[model samples]
Target: MSRSRLMSSSSLSVHGLGKRYGEFVALAPTDLEVAAGEFLTLLGPSGSGKTTLLSLIAGLAAPDDGAIRIGGADVTYRPPYERDLGMVFQNYALFPHMTIEDNIAFPLKMRKVKGADAKKRAAEALELVRLPHVAKRFPRELSGGQQQRIALARCLVYRPSIILMDEPLGALDKKLREHMQLEIKRIHRELGTTIVYVTHDQEEAMTMSDRICLMNSGKIEQLGAPGDLYFRPRTVFVADFLGESNLLPAQVDRNEAGTLAVTLDGGAGSGQAIGNGADLAAGAKVTVMVRPQNITVRPAGEGSGRLKGRLTDIMVTGSLTKLYLEALAPGLPQLVAAYPTRTLSDDHSIGDVLELDWQAQDAVAIPAGQ
Candidate 1:
């Protein structure tokens, strides 16, 4: 119930941790290390193995291969209750018949804490969640958001070594979900508890994680900070999956002075771009990745870079405006640019010819095959 009781977190390590269901691989052999008090999110689409990895870590499922260690102790075959880990699922998973205080104290009771000690600890957990006033209310009497806070309070009451959350905010509405995201983040920061969260929402992962482990086809596709995964993706899938990208087909012309010069296919555009430290030989096929926000739109012949297109559509969404342009060159896909709504001139309209340009440092040229 004290601050020290809540702050005793631990590190987690997964070495070649894998899971399989007959011929289908739910999670490929993977190696990962989460530092003590670090917030890491397992992020990917439904079948990408994020949930499977979380399940394996929570000891809900046994790994077919590899080992899992928490705080330097092997927990690969430990049961869920014996792993010293707490979990928050999509559902609140609270006992409807129990009072909020009792629900939060349930874990301590199971651990054989006396009635007086359990009651005091439950009060402290509710205060930690800023919901001490709702201790007497039952789960059914509270709003969805309040119930979720209670669930988290329950998880914290036991003072587990690590906390694992599987889309804990998935059941809430958008506004409430966003609010709870901040609440959970605040609690994590205050408790300094090492947390492994699983979510399919990229924005959620980006907002909450110190590092994102992006999985694809039961394997880790990329692992890094949100900005690194967004701006310096290692593969085409990482580029396309994390955000909106203009993937221009190109052929490498040369690799000189840390820059890779490339010629765009269909003569759409040509420019120098940064590579991912790999030597790309001349005439090699590649894809130039440029984020929508990095593209600048200007009058023809006004910008330094050369790529001309006709504006096809304009969309305004409150603070940001999106411009869709179709290149004049054949075989090139349409390009999109997003800018602050106030920065765009009202004179620009659809069907207007415009020039597109981006800094070389802002673009990356990746191998075509990844």
Candidate 2:
């Protein structure tokens, strides 16, 4: 099906939204636009105000300042019941006294839907989550994954245009959580619902979101697609938070052709700056972040030997190995690289000095204090 066919007719807009608790600011005056059917993830650590922003949108809490619009209609002062939103929580929030059918039909009841029509909607919703045969079961009789699906079905039964999910899969184990990720993607594609999801897990955000709004200290740090945020981070906080990072201080040498050249601090290495384009003057202090998987370890002097460090540790995890290398001089932070376990050289061992290399374009350089 065409994407537009699956998308809602309206978008969610937050205009200068602000919230405060006593002397502490929970959310700064901020504006954001979530396109219809877009899956946007609010990503950050606890206490970062992501939840506070979500609450304001859900009308669970009134914003101290700003207006929220659903498809261009103002809803800032509206009550939760009037906002037309579907919510899924970390806890299943299922009623133990109710059967699966009753739980799914509760929202329709509130909307005054009953009798055959309500039952039909409940059945369709149960089948939407692939639990068509579970209507006769009670919440206590279902597994965690099944109960979570029931919660999802309950949320979908009413067909709200906007869905807000606050760590809905957080209660599941890793394997099941992963499985549900694909399921959620499938559901989202089929329904064309505009989903605003919140999670602290970077991997989950990257896997499921069309765009990620990374938050820090109660503010948005960066907003972009997963690969753009991962490969071309604009700030040090963004670089370190999104994934594994090898951050090294560096000085700009010059811009060569379309690429900028830089000298690594502590004699780490010198290479062309690829995707990062923070304007910097010569000798400006900047930090370059490289992912562990990008760095290659080779026997010292075997290749370019651009930088040499002593192998200090080897951490093996099934198919991959984490190799730690530190500079010969004291005080330099160790470099961590990921290598395929099957291809690791038997000749190399801890205490063996090795040359570490990475494609210049693979590193993202950010200005100091960014």
Residue 120 in model 1: lDDT: 89
Tens digits of lDDT, candidate 2, 1-370: 3434323535999988999999999999988899988999999999888999999999999999999999889999999888889999999999899999999999899899867999988888887889999899999999999999999989988888899999999999999999899999999988889999999999999999999999988789898999999999999889989988888878888866536678877766676666366667677787878899998788988856666789888888778888888876444577888877875455679899888788878887788889
Worst 10 residues of 2 by lDDT: 1-10
**RMSD after CA superposition, every candidate:** 1.6, 2.1
Per-prediction tally of clashes: 0, 1
Kindly list the per-residue Cα lDDT of model 1 for residues 274-298, writing each as its tens digit: 9965678899898889998898889
lDDT of each: 0.90, 0.86
Candidate 2 structure lDDT:
0.86
Model 2: residues with Cα > 4 Å off, grouped in runs: 1-9, 329-331, 343-347
Give the range of the ten consecutive residues with the poorest summed lDDT in model 1: 1-10
Q: Which candidate is the best by TM-score?
A: 1
